[model samples]
Target: MFCASVEQMKSIDRRAITQYGIPGVVLMENAGRGVVTVIEKSFAVGRGAEVLVVCGVGNNGGDGMVVCRHLLRRGASPRCFLVGKKSRMKGDAKTNLHILEKCGIDVVEIEDRIPRQFTRSLGRSVLVVDALFGTGFRGKLKGCALEVVERINRSRLPVVSIDCPSGLNVDTGCVDGSCVEATATVTMCVPKVGLVFYPGRRWVGELWVVDIGVPEQAIAEEGMLTSLLESHDIHMPPRDPAGHKTTFGWVAIVAGSSGLTGAGAMASLACLRCGAGMATLCLPESLNAALEAKLTEVMTYPLPETDAKTLSLNALELMAPVLKKADVVAVGPGLSTHPETEQLVRSLIEKVDLPMVVDADGLNALSGKLRILRRRKAATILTPHPGEMARLTKMGVPEIMANKPGVATRFAGENRVTTVLKGAPTIIASPKGEVLINSTGSSALATAGSGDVLTGVIAGLLAQGLSSTDAAATGVFLHGLAGDIMAERRTEYGVIATDLLESIPEAIELVLGSERGFFEGGVRRVL
Candidate 1:
């Protein structure tokens, strides 16, 4: 589904109201009702539970006002706290405030100081509805509003924020200052970009996207390119029952050295686990014994090795014939950055005609010579962490991380290759400007050798007739899902790369066997 920025969301809302003829008040009513539904189902609020609705003077506040009316109808007593002066509310918000008063619901307008009664109300409430800000908000909260937000957070009551957490920057996912730590957020129309990205993600606990009468045509007309990858987005082709081993693609992995043989073995094993029909690990001849002993299912090809026990330039000839039989080539896991090895990597990159997933030291070898990516004939996928992407783009790590989607998209567009910028909320960008923000993964994936498993998963998918874009997108999602599964079974701190690899089948099963999509806490019926 498309993840919208503040401007995109505003444009979509405006278009829906103006051209599509959907009333703004009706939209606000839908948003409010949807939030109340989530509250009723998730929190189980009823007559005995009191809801404290903290609202601002904006439309987001209007939505909160509507929520108060809905809660009253549902046999719940909702205390509405208006942070600013009552007269400050205008338009739909003003209308809703009047409607709340007409319904005999209590509306506490806090102008200068927070009333002691409001604090008591917060203490007695079962849930806090935070409708202080919307997507358009920026900067820090100050004055009475700041006090109210801080007090609400300290109250330890479960908060359900409307649209977004009050202090989050919707576009960049940055928190300038004090932001509401919501227990759940009911975003309207579609999920905002910030909620899925980090920093802001920490504050947006459980997320639910609600339909607020915004026409699908209006959102589609905005031409939003960025999207959050959900389980429904994954599409894997069915295997032919009559087909043999050769029916699925063959993957040739050029990785590892004497000491880094484990990296190559992991990548090769991940390929087979991801459904690649055949996988061959081509590494330094000296590491064959160790790799062969470690990997039983994957075939091993010993290449010419240098004195340092890394693949030498002479191995390129042997790899050329191997590439001719392979459907895809994955290079650069565990390969040391020795001068000769770097040279060999550069040569193989330019010479290999097969679709490739280049990662690890392979990215390091191409640091200054990124022009070689533009010269490749077949599809080239560069899987880089922030440090590697920084080296490739000649920018600092912080800069690359701050604007990962932009950096990955720009690099992919300029180099004419697919770019999988690896990090939390991993970004997969196609040369055509299509970008997918992965919605799976956890801190457990921070462990070593995890990226090698990812590289192998992408290569395995590529070998199975997936395009570079689809392969990378699918691989990253499955890799993260595997990590998530591992994190659940074993604690996040204890999860290793092998654990992630072991869970790949279960992850694939979860993706294929189930019809649900990802939510904040776990898989739920798609909203």
Candidate 2:
């Protein structure tokens, strides 16, 4: 599904209203009705339940007015609490608030401060509808608005935030000060960016992106985009029965060190698990035995190793013969970020002709030298969490996490490389200005070596002949699906990177099950 940022939605709204001649208030009514439909499906406003509709002085609260009217019509004695005074409400909100008075539903207007006992009365309320702010809000909540959010949060009440949870940066996904902790957030039109990233994600319990009768072409015109990749936006890898192992492709991985052989092992294993026809690991002669003992499916080549058990200058010379055949190259995963290693990484990045998936120490090698991304002959996919992304982009982790999709999309397009900014809602950006978000994975993936596994997954996909964009997008999706399965079998905290890998086959089977006939041939699994 496509996700449009707030700015795009506004432009589209203007186009529909001014150009197409659709009344703005009519569209708002459609949006409010959609929210009611969603709320009805997810929750039950118990018989005579005290429903509190907390509204601000805006169009979003006008939506709350519609909710109150619907509930009162349902025989529920609901109370309407206008956050601002009656004099402040205008336009449609004023019309709806006045209509509430006519309908005999009491409208209690809070002047300057929210009474201490106001939200406390929420002890008996089954639900609280949050209509404080909309997607246009940039910064944070404050004063009475801020206090009301805190009070509602302290009450442990089930809140249903309209459009988006109040006080979230709709474009960047940042929550500056305070936001409503909603039981579920009902997003109108396309989902805002804040619903997917960290702190905003924390406030929004469950997310449902509802359409409000807007045409798909609206986004096509504005050109603003959000990265929320769904299943349809991907290209599946082709499987030909007439092909040999070489037809799929080969991956040459440069990883492993004296004490860090495990990183290499995980990377190689991930490539094999991701369906690579072959994964060749070029390691220093000293670390060969250890890596060999740890990996089975991956072929190993001995390169020059220094006395320190790391890649030497001679190793770069030896890689000349094998680099020509590799479809994908993995530079660093556990190879320590030493000065000598940085030189080796820079040389390989410049020399390698195949697409590269750089991770861990490989990313560290180029922290201060990000311009190296522009000098690459082949496609480059950099997988970095907020911290590593911060180092590469020269921005803080907070900044990267807040505007992750923007940062990743900007850097990837600027440097002509694909970037996978890893986090909740992992963003995959291609240089062509296309962005895809992975809406999968579990918190259990927060453990060590998980990134090595991820690097492997993407490399393996690249080796299996997927495009740089498809490989990165598919790799992150499958990686997260594996984590989700692992989390289901073993709780979030119990799932490790190895557990993530172990769950891949089942995840693949589950996904492949969706497109059964092609993969299953003439037969089918009864289950």
Candidate 3:
């Protein structure tokens, strides 16, 4: 599903109303009705269920009014509270306020503060509908609006936010002050970027995108660059039944050192586990025996090593035949930043003709030499956590974290390489400027050697003929799914990176499962 920014969404909404002739009120009604549908199905809202609909003076408030009317029609008791001045309401919002009053549903206006009676009402309410803000909302929650949002949160009721959780910066997901921590957000038209990005994503529990009658052409014409990766987007290429080892794909892994041999082993093993036909661990000549003993199914090639036992600059010449035979190269995991080794990495990055997945030390080698990326002819994927990203771009961690999608997108576009910005929700950006936000994984993935496993996954997928973007996106989703599965089995605290390896196949199967369903046309559940 396409993830739109505030301006793009506004433009899409405008084009839908003006070009496609969709009435604004009809769209508001659809949005409100969609929220009601979610409340009914997700929360089991039924007759006599007391729902507190906290509305503002904007169209968001109008959406809340529609919710109240729908709840009343369903025999549910809904108390509507307007957080701003009723007179300030305009257009569809003003029309909805008058409609609510005519239907005998009293609209309590709170101009200064939330009365003590509102607190008592909160105790009686089964759910709180947060229509006090929308995607256009920015800055902090202040005045009576902040009070109402605080009380709703303190009430501990299942709150459903309309469009966005009040106080959220829909573009950046940064909350300046207090923001409503919703149980679910029923975003209209398309999922917003902030809803998928961090800090803002934390507040949005289950995300359900609802179609508010926006034209498909309007969205397409908008040319949204970012999209939330859905299960359907992961297409595992079919295996040739008669294909042998080399036919599947061969991953030549140039990684490992004396102490960090596990990184290379994990990368090579993950390649095989993720269905790569072969994975050759090309490492320091001295450490080959130990790695050979550890990785039973993986092949080991001893290469010339520096005094520190890291890949020496001499290995670059030896890699010619390895690159000649391999389908893809997985570089950087645990490869120490020894002077000669770093030089070797930079050399291979500039000279290698095969597609590569660069991670850990490999990214470090390119820190001051990123210009080399622009010269590469084949596809290159850089999987960097925020710290690595900061070093590569010479930006602070906070700045990069502030806008992961934007940072990743810019880096990929500038260097013409696929970038996987690894974080809570990984952002995959391609050289073509397309971005994919991964939807799987949990805190359980915060483990050592996890990224090494990811490097292998992507390299394996690339070897299997997946495009750079597809490989990175698919690998990330599957890697996170594996972490999720382990988290479910052993809790987040107990799972490690190696644990994710065993679950990769299961994760792949789960995503490829037949039980998946779409919410509606042009509207899909993104969480």
Candidate 4:
């Protein structure tokens, strides 16, 4: 399913009208009707409820006008509050305001010295429709609008936002000014990218992609595709019965040291959980005993170790033999940054000839030396969080977080390495120069040994013969989904890395199973 931004959706909407001959007014009417229909169904207090419709002087305000009219039809008295002077509104918004005035809906011109007074007077309204700003807003809110949102928070009324919450960046999930805290949002046509990620999602609440008669073909014709992977998107047709284990491919992981043995174990387990046909963890000799007991299903090979228990240069010969037979190579989990250990990392990276996913200290070892990956024989995917990405890109963590999608796409294209920038809304940047944002995983996945597990999952996918793009995209999603399930089973703060490792099966089941969250609460329809 396509997850679009306000700008992208607007382009589609415009093309549908201009080229396809659908009038703008008719589209607006359909959009407004969809919002009202969702509101009538979702809001419990209706009919005689006192609904407060807060509208700005824009097309978004126009949507609020339509909502007010529909509420009136439903036998509710809606108190309409127009934020600015009537003369400020234009286009379809002006038309709706005129219709609202003639219909005798009391449109109050709020003369509060500060807009905070307006929200205080709203007193326990059954609903507050936030149509303050729409997609056309290019920056943060200010003055009266900011004041209005703050008091709305204080009023404690359930907010129903039309289109989008006021101050969210639709493309990036970055938050700037005061945003609406809606109980539910009626997103006409497709879901916004912002609603699926954090900070923006923190404000969007429960999202309803209310269809407004926009055909899928029309959206596709405009070439505005935001790839969102539901279970159906990841579903591949069933394989032939004759297919065997080798058909899935093989993955080798070069990871772990004495104290960091847990990282390699977690990753190797993820490889099997994610459906790798053959998976092996090759680690330093000294730690194999503890790791062998910790992990039984995964095959382990012990190599020469240093005094500090990190992999020594002598281990490279042993790793070379394994790398020759492996389809994917996952390196750099729990391999501490000792100089000799970093040298071992550099040698293996330069010589290995398999698809690679380098993560954690593996990333730290190659921090300023990305030129090494440019020399590899097979495909490469770097799974780096913003902190690691900052080290790779020579920028601060704040800068990387602010414009993640843009940075990931540009960097991956430039470096010729598939890059997965990990965090909320994890981004997968392909060597082909395309970027995808993943919506899986919970904040609960922010525990120890998580990155190591991700390295294993991606390696496992690569071993299964998936393209680097598909592996990174699917791996990030699956990793996050596992985190979400584990977090639900154990609260977000309580779920550990091992819990994420354990819940991979549950996440796969939820995706493949019959549960699809639709109308009503809690998504329990078995189909």
The number of clashing residue pairs in each candidate reads 0, 2, 0, 1
Judge candidate 1 against the unseen true structure and give its global Cα lDDT, from 0 to 1. Answer: 0.89
> Which window of 10 residues has the lowest lDDT sum in candidate 4?
518-527
Question: Can you give the lDDT of residue 350 in candidate 4?
Answer: 85
- Candidate 4 Cα misplacement greater than 4 A, ranges: 3-6, 111-121, 138-140, 169-177, 193-198, 236-240, 514-527
Clash pairs for candidate 3: none
Show pairs that collide, candidate 1: none
Question: Which residue pairs come into collision in candidate 2?
Answer: 173-194, 229-437
lDDT per residue (tens digit) for residues 25-139 in model 2: 6777666666666666677876688888888888888888877887877777677887787788788777887887899877777668876446555777878888878888877
Task: Please provide, for model 1 over 180-218, each residue's C-alpha lDDT reduced to its tens digit, 9 standing for 90 to 100.
Answer: 999998898888888888878899988888877687789
Q: Candidate 2: where are CA atoms >4 Å away?
A: 98-102, 113-121, 138-143, 368-371, 510-527
What TM-score, over all chains together, does every model reach?
0.97, 0.90, 0.97, 0.91
Question: So what's the TM-score on candidate 3?
Answer: 0.97
Q: What is the lDDT for 58 in model 3?
A: 93
Model 3 spans > 4 angstroms off: 514-517, 520-524
Instruction: For residue 241, give model 2's deviation from the true position in Å.
Output: 3.6
What is the C-alpha lDDT profile of model 3 across 179-239, one tens digit per residue? Answer: 9999999999888989988899999989998888787889999999899887888888669
